[model samples]
Target: MALTGSLDAAAQAKAAKAEAYKAPRTAFGQPDLSGYWTNNTMTPMTRRPGVSSLVYTEDEVKKMEAEAEAEVEEGNAPTDPNAGAEAAKPAASSLRPEFAAAGGDVGGYNRGWLDPGHTVMRVRGEPRSSLITTPNGQIPPRKKGAPPPPGFGRGLGSFDSYETRSLGERCIIGFGRNGGPPMFPNGFYNNNYQFIQTPDHFVIEVEMNHDLRIVRLNAKHRTDDVRPYFGDSIGWWEGDTLVVETTHIPQSQGFMGSWKDLKVTERFTRVGPQRVHYAFTIDDPTVWDAPWGGEYEFAPLNGRIFEYACHEGNYALPGILAGARAEEQAAAEAAAAKAAEAAKSKAKDKKAGD
Candidate 1:
């Protein structure tokens, strides 16, 4: 790409500019955004079905949050020591669909280990009904006959090969759009990040998948048609706000399956001592008629960033493939054994007739 350069140049530039950072502000007098922050909340990227507004009333917020808080309490209550295995099964109906997986499946977290924040996402003073600020508070419709979003979920596709699995399953990147051009909450845990800004680059160290995103400052988009994770991000300072433009997003990582020609513009501004107002807009004429995205606030993460170590001690993928093969072989053996039994019975009947 005419724009893409080796990470070496970027790294060297950042190393040189590292000296320019004076706490939160660079020597250039730009607002500093170096800190550990989180965008974890109950709010989802798209609007909920049948919801008509962007902002929720205080009463509505209280009721929804109370429900979430109660669910946690119920989950945290001590279980009967002699409870049956069935008790470990995750009941999707027991919690909101958005949070049903908090319990995961059998042998997963219950409540105390879970970290889907209870509070619905609030932008400024108002509770947000949805993140997308579009007129309908939803992703705009695709052009007629536009292709469906590609890729299959763990259960929906063949798992014969590791490549067949989802990116999250392979531990290639954080699942649920965690390492995003327009980053979004994973709807699960590990939604934390550290922002390290140098005069030449802005780096977001994602706690999930240990994804490291480097944003080149005042750089040009690559014309090489290369699509990599986190895309190609170039940023500039607009007053105290850092405006970033990302393109060439990989199709598998596309937002709602709209990646080609996608350009995501994100603005990160330190709005308060404890919050950073993160806003984004997506534009892809091939997919939608107009651009649409949403805004959310990043609160300070109480803890430090830790290694995700997705592949280490993760036997789920190996187990999935091995288990599938074992099941297939068992089924084939049973079928052959049944055929042999039927042949033997037929031979005995023939002998009697003879």
Candidate 2:
């Protein structure tokens, strides 16, 4: 009887603690969201094949972490310069077979430069396989035979002009959706973000390419013709959550081919002292048959954001144009030489006949 009474008292105490918890507020009486945060995780946007569940069992999580540690060890292994060419081939199980070839020479950077988080994403004390919460754990399929919307710099055909390259390659926006209306982790380094909130505005400063997203508070979106890179975002406080609605996204800066009439709704709520719950929904009738959404949590980081400085040292543009010019000149010379040879053969044949 005494043990039962003790258990009841403990349960009541836990309930009381939960009731006493409250979110911290800003000086202006808004939920404080001003801090440096990181959304880096090993959790993929879609569930891996053969994984039947969204949440992993404790044993499954342990095995996953162990595999990750082994991968990290293999990646950090010292490369032997004297190794033979035959020894450099990629294993069949490698995630990126192209990078594994030639001792990673073809790939831009070594494994040391990559920092796609080591562990799976933990939300509400459970390790999740994917951030996407749909029944299939994947982004909704696009409409049948739906072509990608036309926009500037959409394809890479010729390097005759700078506009042919992607916006991210041109250093105009963050690459791989690092700076987004529905921001996601880049799966590489520089996955940090800094949030600054004011009475009239909220800013999300992305670490990659140093992209900044300025969201107006309690305001309407800009005119439709004035599309921005990350879209025109307007926010309002709903209880402890900051609700953001974004529209007028530039077609060139569309996410997953959902640009035309795309609408993104995001909610940010401080669920714990060090954690912020983030959820976003993608709505575009022209692209997907139905709206799809994902949820994830952001954890506070210790350091401040630093400048990315990408364009200042970029030399690829001039190099690409120069290579194209050389190829064009060579093709023209070959054609001219072939025509001259044909004319000379005709003259020689006429002289022989006379």
Candidate 3:
């Protein structure tokens, strides 16, 4: 009886402390993370299976942070993947997770270039396995071996070349996991985001491709004909949380060959003065099994999202095609030369036999 009393008192006290730390609200009493916010934590795209669903103990979070710092330190010192076999063990394959499966073998950026951080922010104190809450943090397998997002095909001429390329290689959108059908975070820099709020609307601006998602608060849903880049989004205030449902995503802006039918529902709540808890649920029957969801705590960035001028007609496209054509041409000429040499040898052998 005495032990139970003590436990109840401790629980009440913890709850009281949490309530005290909760940020004071706006004039309308909405928690405000309206400033520039970024989540730079290095939590991987998929959760490690053995990890617990609950937040990490303080000691564990610290250990993970320390490991991340060590990785950064090692990356600062350049090491070659082609170094002696023993030295090369440090450079393991980057293509382990399903995250890399969609991106078939585009190579040569070092681990040093990646800013994926080590410890995720403990929002309300839970250390996350991934932002994903679903069993096995993944986007579910692609159906029927849908060919991975199309790569730049070899071009026959000028017009046929640039128009048919990948969005990222042409410098139009962020590559791989950057400019998402559902806007996934990536290894590259500029993972920052900013939220601007008015009474009637909320705008989320992701730094990749300068993708801006506009949510009409307390507004009517779009009709079926109204397709959009990031899809048409509508928001409503559900208690203190802002729930935004998005649909009608254009095929051009999707991942895993599923933009047309993709549906993303996101919730934003100002949990702390500096941190906005961002959670999203992705639902595309064509792409995922059930509605897989994830959450990440956004840390405050000091400034606004800078310009991301991802232009289309860059020299990179031309360069890539030119490089491919040159290799093909060289191979063709070599084959012809080898055939001619074989014919001459055959003629000499026939004459000697005669």
Candidate 4:
């Protein structure tokens, strides 16, 4: 009886300690959210095939992780130049070596450059297969007859001008939505971020392409005409949670065909000393049948952020244009040659008939 009473007292004390825990505050008495954080995880933006549920069992998670590790190993393996064509054929599940190569050229980067996390993202102690939390664990389908989003769905032949290139290829925004109002993991390298807080504003600096997002605290969003990359974000504190709303996303930078009328609301709260809980809801009546949302946890990183200089000394843009011109020149030459051959054959046939 005495031992049971002691155990109960200890449990009560522990509960009290947890109840008293509060996030550190800034000089102006706001919850301090300044830190280096990473959203890196193996969790995909949408549920993968064969994953039926949003949450995975422990055994399922282990199996998925093992498969990912095996893929990493294969990616890191050295290729033999002397190998025959039969040996070069990639597995049906894997990308062709040429496709995987940087710029679709020879001598691509090794897998060491990849830092896709080893494990699925954990939310509330459950391993999640996808970041999206819709009943289907995917983004809602586009409204019927809605026009496809700009920049995509035009097929691969639209590279006639620099403006037709993707935002990432142009170095205007981080690839894979790394800098977003509903920021998500890239499933590749440069998945870190730094959060800097001030009395009246908050800033989130993404590691990929060195993109930055600034949120004005307790302020209204900018006018509708002033669209910005990652949209115009305004934030306010609701108890311990920092609530942010973003709007005015440009049409060219739309998210999954939803940017024109999209509004993203995000909530951030420090749930533990080393973890922050992040949740976001996406609403775009112009695109989706209904709204959707997701939840994930951001863990503190020990290292400092580094700069990603995407455009310095870059020759890819000019090279692409030059390649296009070369193709056009070759096509025109071939047509002229064919026409000349036909004309010569017709003149010879006429002389023979005479």
Residue-wise C-alpha lDDT for candidate 3, range 1-354, written one tens digit per residue: 001012235445643554465555556656554778777666765667787443455687788788767766755676575776445333334332432323223343444656565566554556665656555555466666454654333223444466666555565556545434355567556788877788778888878777677888888778766776667888887766788888887766665566767787888776656667777777877665566667777788767788887554557666777887898899999999999999999999999999
Per-residue error for 330 in candidate 3, Å, reads: 7.2
lDDT of 3 at 143: 66
Off by over 4 Å in 2: 1-21, 84-107, 148-158, 311-314, 346-354
Please give each candidate's TM-score: 0.82, 0.85, 0.70, 0.81
Clashing pairs in 1: 24-32
Better of 2 and 4 by TM-score: 2
For candidate 3, the per-residue lDDT at 120 reads 64
**How far does residue 95 in candidate 3 sit from its true spot (Å)?**
13
Model 3 lDDT, full chain set: 0.64
Per-residue lDDT of candidate 1, residues 228-322 (tens digit): 89899999988778999999898778877788888999999876667788899889888888877888889999989987875788788888899
User: What's model 3's lDDT at 283?
Assistant: 80
TM-score of 2: 0.85
* Predicted model with the maximum TM-score: 2
Better of 1 and 4 by lDDT: 1
Stretch of 10 with least lDDT, candidate 3: 1-10
Better of 1 and 2 by TM-score: 2
RMSD of each: 9.4, 6.3, 7.5, 6.9
Give the winner by lDDT.
1
Q: Which stretches of candidate 4 lie over 4 Å from their true place?
A: 1-21, 77-107, 149-156, 311-313, 332-354
Ranking by TM-score: 2, 1, 4, 3
